[model samples]
Target: MKAAIFFERDGVLNLCETRHGHQVVPLRLEQFKVNPVASVLLHQLKLAGFVLIATTHQPAVARGDLSRNELDLMHMILRRKLPLDDIMLCPHDDASHPCQKPQPGMFLEAAFKWSLDLDRSYIISDKWQDAKAGQVAGCTTVMIRSPWIGDDHHDFVVDDLETAVAKIGLLQNNLYGREVAMA
Candidate 1:
């Protein structure tokens, strides 16, 4: 089984606009911009042998504000810029669509599809929904210090993506050291 790193798409991997104090997805392909710092941070995790997956909740599609083609175009740009192995999305507007965030469905689906060891995997996100999902999925959750990350339970809180990646590196190294000691 493989241990994967699940990243939240909006604020973590790319830049988005704020609407009423909430981070909202960009409406057009022209407005989409991938964060350059994400590449270096994710590359470090990739080199450590973790399968990188990006998970997102795009309710705008179901709400009729965003088209699937436009979303696909955005993801295409993301794939070209990031070291992501897969991009998982939930297009539903609510719990009626079980794959949405705060529901472990997307993470669970990724685990099944990628043969992931959920207990050993990690989730890096800037919002509370992803952290909640990660907790239920048995993955360690790391939350970026953002206003979107409300009062939530998380395994680690870091200032930025680089810091989060460093924490993951330490966790991986500590596990490796323990295994070597056991041997």
Candidate 2:
């Protein structure tokens, strides 16, 4: 089985705006802006033999605020800009939905599809929901410090994506040894 790194969309991979302390998802193609730095950081993980996956909770679709086609276009742009292996998304508005964040359904589904070792994998996000989900999925949770990062279960907290990548590198080295992790 291979290890994977799950990245939260919106704030992590693409740029997002904060409104009243909450990160807002771009509703239109014009609003979507992929972060350039993420491309390089993700390439490092890809070279380390880890599957790069982007997981997101797009509840706006269920609420009828956003269309699937628009979301797909945004995802296409994200794929073109980032070295992501797969993008998993839940369009459910209900928190109880199995695939939604704070639930491990998406992670578990990815694990099954990719034959991934969750215990050896990691999750990077700016939201607490991903951390909660990662905890239940058995992946090491690395949260990017933000207003949405609730006081919940998380393995590591970093100030930025570069730092998060570095932290993951250190953890990988400690877990699998330098040569194995690099290979």
Candidate 3:
């Protein structure tokens, strides 16, 4: 089985607007802006042989705030810009839904479909719920320091995606008992 890195879509990959301490997902293609730094950072992970998958909880779609077609167009642009292997989404407003964050459903499904070694994998996100799911899913969890990152069980906490990726590199090296430089 191969290792994978799961990323939370909203703040990690793209720029998200904060309104009253809450992230506002882009409802239109014009509002969606991909982060410039993400490309180089993600390229390093991809070249290091980790399958990159994006996991997101877009409840706005379920609430009729965002359309599926618009979301699809955003993801298409995201995929074209980033080296992501797959993008998993939970467009449900129901919290108990299997694929919702704070649940391991999305991670488990990705594991099954991608033949991933969960133990060797890692998850990066700015939310506590994603960390919780990553822990339950048996992957090392790295939380990017943010207001939304609640106090929860996680393997590491870093300031930004670049630092998070470096931390993953260190952990991956330790797991394999070698110092493989992350380019």
Candidate 4:
């Protein structure tokens, strides 16, 4: 089974902000901000031969906070700067749609599109629901620290992107070495 790595966009890969007492998910291209360690981690993951994918729940579009075109522009910026192989977004709100986070639909879609082996894949997110979705999809889930979530279920936890990258490297080394020894 081939391995892949999936990332959540808003708080994990970029800074999320609140405006007018509402949480904003950076819909504009100019508002898009990448985390300081994102590029470094992405480069390392690419070197490790992991297929990089982004899985996000963008409820802003469903809530009329942002249009689909604007969201596309924002993703274009991300694609230009990151070593992303694909981006999958759930553009529906929780109330109107159940296919959002905590639902395995998005991850399932990604696995199908990319022919990913969920058992050998990793999903990184700063939200509990996102982690839950990944977990339900049979992927190793890592939670990045976030104030929004008090507690949640995840396979692993890491301080930041760099630390997450290091953990992945260690896991890959151990797994690959075991495979080689067996062979």
Best by lDDT: 2
1-183: candidate 3 lDDT, tens digit per residue:
999999999999999989998898899999999989999999999999999999989999999999999999999999999999999999999999999989999999999999999998999999999889988889999999999888779889999999999999888768667534442
> Which parts of model 1 have CA positions greater than 4 angstroms off?
none
Q: Where does the lowest 10-residue lDDT sum fall in candidate 3? A: 174-183
lDDT of 4 by residue, 120-183 (tens): 9998887777777877889888777766433767888898777777888888889989999999
Q: Please rank every candidate by lDDT, starting with the best.
A: 2, 3, 1, 4
Candidate 1: residue pairs that collide: none
lDDT of 1 by residue, 1-183 (tens): 999999998888998778798887887898889987998888888898999999988888989999999999999989888889999989888875679889899999999999999999999999998888898999999898899788978899999888999999899889999999999
Query: Cα miss at 138, model 4 (Å)?
Result: 0.9
Badly placed stretches (over 4 Å) of model 4 are: 18-23, 95-98
User: Which residue window of length 10 is worst by lDDT in model 4?
Assistant: 144-153
Residue 103, model 1, lDDT: 83
The lDDT values for all models are 0.90, 0.93, 0.93, 0.81
- What does candidate 2's lDDT look like per residue over 1-183, in tens digits? 999999999899999989987788999999999987999999999999999999999989999999999999999999998899999999989978899989899999999999999999999999999999999999999999998889989999999999999999998677668677689
Residue-level lDDT for 142 in candidate 2: 94
> How do all models score by TM-score?
0.96, 0.95, 0.95, 0.89
